[model samples]
Target: MRRTTTVWMTGGLGLIAAGVLGMLRDNLVGSAGAPVIAAAAEILAAAALLLFAIGTSRESSVVARRPLGVIALVVLALWPFATQFIGRLLSPSEPIGDLAWSVFGVASVLVPAAAGFIAAVQIARADTVPSPWNRAPLWVFGLHVVAWVVPQLLFAAVGADDIQGLAGLFLTLGKLAYLAGTLGLGIVAVLLANRRRTTTVPVFQSASTDRD
Candidate 1:
């Protein structure tokens, strides 16, 4: 396999592993090692994001050519670490710290959401990637944002206190959707790598000698 393909595959698998770790952490909540598991999940996620960002930038000049897009991808990749740093620096129990964290938390979501959206659009526009598959980023990131925002909007509109059970249901559904979207991104990455491998032809191979 080509070096680029290997990078893509490794990054994709890393994302899948991170998602599984996240699931495990969620299930192990309240257990003795839950904090450890959660920390592992975050670390794995950050590394995976960095790898994926590198792979994407390598694959498409569109992403690499634009400074803003590249910056967004780097920011997205570093988000997990940023969150961890903020958590350590600020005590959530204090009112000022809590407010600071609240603002940062919102930025954590919004900034990444915006970055992902920009990356997805750029990837979709790049001719280097195949049609339809190029659009996979949109499905992965767009669904995530939709899943996150819809429930909050609905809960606010209906008044969370008025329908607590409904609110819980919405929250649960949103989490499930988010999980699905996360897994979907990994799957899409693997598929894209496979597609590239199957479609690519080595420059050294002549047309007559090249096998289908």
Candidate 2:
């Protein structure tokens, strides 16, 4: 019912679908077509998040805003990182710029991820807020960080040469992490979307209307 819930639910589901696609590459689907499906899913998820970030302000009704506002903005910024890699996948030889750029850029996701953590805490600390952020659940964002964001950061840091004998081991872990994060986000979103909140009518207003 709530816009926040709707958007978050969609964002979460998108992430989960993307994660499933990411894993299919190694399964019966085989490596060739699976990577393409995964890439498409990732792009779709990223694009959805980017669009959802734009909705935060509109959903909040252009208010003075809160920390979640910045969180949305940062999340919007984070999606572009995926596009760069996606571009590389589509055209590897075209040079998507330095890999170092990707490493550092991907790390920026930590900013919003941290912000989301703080926002979730803030919600827990306070009460009686308006829409756009009120009653929004965010533990899933942390899951996303643990599952995908952390792995990306580590992947960037641990080059092929650095892994040496542990390449396959870490690579598999990295892939698993992404899948977990995406699915976690999706589940959280769906839970939030279906959540129910009790609304109480003002006693005075009810009495006044009855009296009339």
Candidate 3:
């Protein structure tokens, strides 16, 4: 098995850890909450993206996918750090509304979304013989989008202040759903890598058949 396969699988595991951390952070209420824990989520997520990109780049059969993976990882890696900068910019005098952080947030999500799509396309369009895991690429992209966009829309539609009854329930549900989706992406990645290992068996299989 290629070392990169293990790398991708390991990265996926890290991503799941990140999502779990995020969910754990959300559960913290009142004074129990800590931003550092949430920060760990982003840091782990970025590391996962980078590791996955490296694995994809090492795959000999995949061509167009490499550059797209690189682009996606770059955005993913930078995503967590942006929040810190945005935080620093916010003050009593310079409020969130006064700045363009909202726009920045929206655009930031789009960057990974676009790159995910591109990389998925590359996996889909590989010129060589395809692996059963090829569809896994699309699954990775899809889950990532679900994690980002679905929660964003759900939370925004029901503002935090407006939540008196079902909104709070939905807010919690949305957060869980986002984490589940993120977890799903990692699961898919590891499964896909596992499946990829079988691709090498055909050569041995054909040789055995020839001998028989």
Candidate 4:
């Protein structure tokens, strides 16, 4: 792979790891853990943005026309906005003791719920490229959305205040799905990077060289 391609690939994987670790920290970490989790998520999201910018830059060697490339760009662009939207949606002025628990409801759960649908549509399109790993991530990530979102929506719609009661559930199951999806995405990123790299390789022999 070209140096640029390697950088993009590495950066993307690192972002994926950061996002996953952030979700864990946000959900599992307590008062002491808050800053660390939030910081990690911020860093990951920032790295994703940086890599996306470089990948989308005119100077980047990777072709933007490819389907996976397009999806990666779109995902990176939307990720931060999704997190911001969730933060706004969940913000409580009074700051209940367990209120910090709701962060997963928006961050881990809702954002993926929306993004998974978007990814599914893109993957299903006729013009989109196909790969076993890419398709798996698309589907699995979409499913992870369900795993994370349903319980939170159920509890929230009922106006349940026992956030502690559900905290463990969301922290365990919700985070598992979120981490899985992020890891899957990282795998897809690597695959896409490899595909992008191989696309540039030239055939060593001409078609006419084959024996009759």
In the range 136-181, model 2's lDDT, one tens digit per residue, is 4354454455565544565678865664655575566566556554
lDDT: worst 10-residue window of model 3: 56-65
TM, every model? 0.78, 0.50, 0.65, 0.53
Clashes of 4: 0
Which pairs, if any, clash in model 1?
none
Q: After TM-score superposition, what is the CA distance of residue 97 in candidate 2 from its true location, in Å?
A: 8.9
Residues 17-83 of candidate 3: C-alpha lDDT, one tens digit per residue: 9888877887774444557777788888878766665554456323334666467556656765875
Query: Candidate 1, after superposition: displacement of residue 158 in Å?
Result: 2.7
Collision count for each candidate, in order? 0, 1, 0, 0
Tens-place lDDT digits, model 1, residues 17-105: 77787788778889999888778766666666666555544553325345566666678778777877877888877879868988988
Which candidate's lDDT is highest?
1
TM-score of 2: 0.50
lDDT of each residue in 107-186, candidate 4, tens digit only = 55455456555545444442323445436546766566676576769687756776667667766676666565556555
Q: What is the C-alpha RMSD of each candidate to the true structure, in Å?
A: 3.6, 7.1, 4.9, 7.2
What is the TM-score of candidate 1? 0.78
* Model 1 lDDT, residue 101, Cα: 80
Ranking by lDDT: 1, 3, 4, 2
In order, what lDDT does every prediction score? 0.69, 0.53, 0.64, 0.57
User: Which candidate gets the maximum TM-score versus the true structure?
Assistant: 1
lDDT of 3 at 128: 26
